[model samples]
Target: MACNGSYTVVIVPLQNSLYSSDALRFFHWLKKLRALEREKDSLWIGLQVLERTRFWYQHQLDQISQRNARVGTRELDEEEESWSCALRSSMQRVNGSLGSLLNNAYVCSAAPDEMDASDWCLRWTNAVLTQEVSQKNDRISILEFEKEILLQQRDGIHYF
Candidate 1:
């Protein structure tokens, strides 16, 4: 007899056609194998999520760096310098946290039997994604405010 879900069972002839204790043990082992296969699949999925998140963070960092380079070296006012410092610090923290998450995912994938580790990976990924979304919303809001200010200025100039 063969079982599905990545398990194969072989039954050898034992006298006439009759059930045996050995067959029961094989069935139990097959069930256990299937459970392990499911766990392995979950672990694989967590690893893939971590890899994608890492790639996205890296790409964002690259974009920020390029933008900064284009801005060139101009003397920043105190307020601008403070804002720049805060943004740099935030980016560093994000990068460090992402690295830690990737490391945890790698370790968890190595030991798929650790259900707790897999759960932690899922939670961490969710938190990181939420934070990224919030940051993007803030950037969009800031851009919109700037656009409104520019439009108001144009209107005032045309009215003069």
Candidate 2:
């Protein structure tokens, strides 16, 4: 008995070829390095955002402290009053968005019996701003550490 069949033949590259394997490993290493670089860039951007936020908080804190200092037993002159009013208006805008820290809102609700409403509000706002600044500082530190680690990893891959 005789059997008739058609067979198709195709040639494929050897899986264990040294150059192909080396090229594959090189591409993989490049991909890892690129990922590490992107992570480092993101961390840098985060640090910058934290820095800007901290600066804004510091500016607000300074304004609040200045107002606290300027509030005294003696009444202000017209010029001083105008400046104080401007500062107060600016601070009010800040507080307005933060759930109205002034105008007898949260501060008055939680204030001690002896504390005046405005005084309590300023103190409360100052405390909150201070905490925000500290938290931003902590986050900046953490991002910096991560960026440093990412750099080291990227360098290792590059040298490998």
Candidate 3:
């Protein structure tokens, strides 16, 4: 669902399957992956990359502006130097995390294209977008797993 949400805006099969029990397990897997992503985020590594990019680019622009030499130059004329720099540097910072974001580019900007990652993100996002999606799956799984027991009680029959 995560990748589906990010990659396919028009709706896809993966998006529809997020309601299944197996898909829910995939959702749980995604939760673990997101937890790790949160831990890394807590380290401020992402922030550092952003700040590094922002600070450096502005510094470069400032130097250029003060020199009166960068005037009218393509690099100088463009605004949001920090943004451009941030995008590039953030990609570099999360170089190894490509799989985490599913390499969707639209989801987390840091995810890779690995199968596990794509699976996790889709499941994670599915869980996030709708609680009922998960609750329904959970209810179904419990019923399925305990179907025989439930049937015995309801039918007043004893097991061999």
Models, CA RMSD each: 8.4, 29.4, 27.0
Prediction 3 global C-alpha lDDT: 0.55
TM-score order of candidates, top first: 1, 2, 3
Question: Could you give candidate 2's per-residue lDDT for residues 17-86 as a string of tens digits?
Answer: 6478766776555555444444455446657756886798799789768767877955566545655555
Which residue runs does candidate 3 get wrong by more than 4 Å?
1-43, 69-103, 107-160
- Superposition TM-score, candidate 2 onto the true structure: 0.34
Alpha carbon deviation, residue 86, candidate 2 (Å):
18
lDDT of 3 by residue, 1-160 (tens): 1222232123224644768877776666665566555445533654675688688878867875774774555454222454445456644645545455456545543443345566656775685677566458656755664675567566875543
Instruction: Give TM per candidate.
Output: 0.40, 0.34, 0.26
Quick one: how many clashes does candidate 3 have? 8
| Total clashes for model 2 | 0
Cα lDDT tens digits for candidate 1, 1-160: 1224544456555543345777665656555565566556655666786799789779868976876886767644554555556567766876797788778865554433343546655765797699789789768866775676679779989999
Off by over 4 Å in 1: 1-20, 71-160
Query: How much lDDT does candidate 2 score?
Result: 0.58
Write down the lDDT that model 1 would get. 0.65
RMSD of 1: 8.4
Q: Alpha-carbon error at 112 in model 3, in Å?
A: 9.2
RMSD in Å for candidate 2, one decimal? 29.4
